[model samples]
Target: MSDGAPDSLIPYDEIVQEALRAVVGRVLGEVEAAGGMPPGSHHFYITFKTGAAGVDIPAELRARFPDEMTIVLQNKFWDLSVADDHFSVGLSFNQIPAKLVIPFSAITAFVDPAVEFGLQFQAVSEVEEAEPHAEPENDSEQGAGNGVGSEDGDDGSNVVTVDFGKKK
Candidate 1:
């Protein structure tokens, strides 16, 4: 399986990641277009880097989730707004209503268990209008603020994480 080809000259990995992340945006945009999550069934479990630049979350949720958090968009969320690079939503945590603004570049994982579909990306900060985003402060290579998951499906869900073992 080794053709002996060297490393890629172009940042193909980053390019592919961005395109995949766009899927998340497109899905959310559809929801926004419908005025909210469609009449029934579909939902999302989005996990993102809280410390990533352009991420605006409540201090309490920030303190609680710190590096990352998984939010379920099923019933309780409101005022869902989708933008070109980010999305804003209102959700309740422990009876506290809070608003969060997260840039697509900060999202590390997106899952829709109902359809058994999910995606995990190599977490990177995306460029924003006027201000360039910065890499989130973290101590892990797996990114997403959360620790690494198992190679097996033990981590739960049918999420498929693609890790191209190419030389950097």
Candidate 2:
């Protein structure tokens, strides 16, 4: 059979992306409901695109991260607020405090290593334009602290893959 073209019309990518973003929102909502990070667990690794629309990263951070960046939420974080379209959190870097506001649409990944749970997202597009600026000293780096549990099972290697691909 010749691998050519099929005639059909449906917006699967958008639908899947929307659903995945919801999962992020729901998770954050749960955390918010719990008042704060649960005992023995106190951080997150949030990776997102610097250029995504509605993303409100600091000017300095934009320059350093350029394309993408990961943030750590632990000891020195505060005012964590999650909203329908986005979420905001305050984190300290080198004794300097900075606020980060990220739109769910811009998040490319969310991982809670303490629980061995992680989620990967597809970037909206590669052609998206990003603003250029320098990252402030107040932006925290990724994976800077240690929490309670291992991010894996016995052997320390396990990954759960969720394929949102459409069946032909």
Best by TM-score: 1
- Give the CA lDDT, 0 to 100, for residue 94 in model 2: 61
lDDT string, candidate 1, 66-151, tens digits: 56677889988999999989999999988989899999988877877676778887766342331223334433333444532223
Count of residue pairs whose backbone atoms collide, per candidate: 0, 4
Clashing pairs in 2: 60-134, 60-135, 61-135, 63-133
Residue 108 CA error for candidate 1 (Å)? 1.0
Q: After superposition, how far is residue 126 of candidate 2 from its true place, in Å?
A: 8.3
Model 1: which ten-residue window has the lowest total lDDT?
126-135
lDDT of all predictions: 0.74, 0.66
Which residue pairs clash in candidate 1? Answer: none
Candidate 1, residue 139: lDDT: 30
Q: List the candidates' TM-scores in order.
A: 0.77, 0.72
Model 2 residue runs over 4 Å out of place are 1-8, 126-168
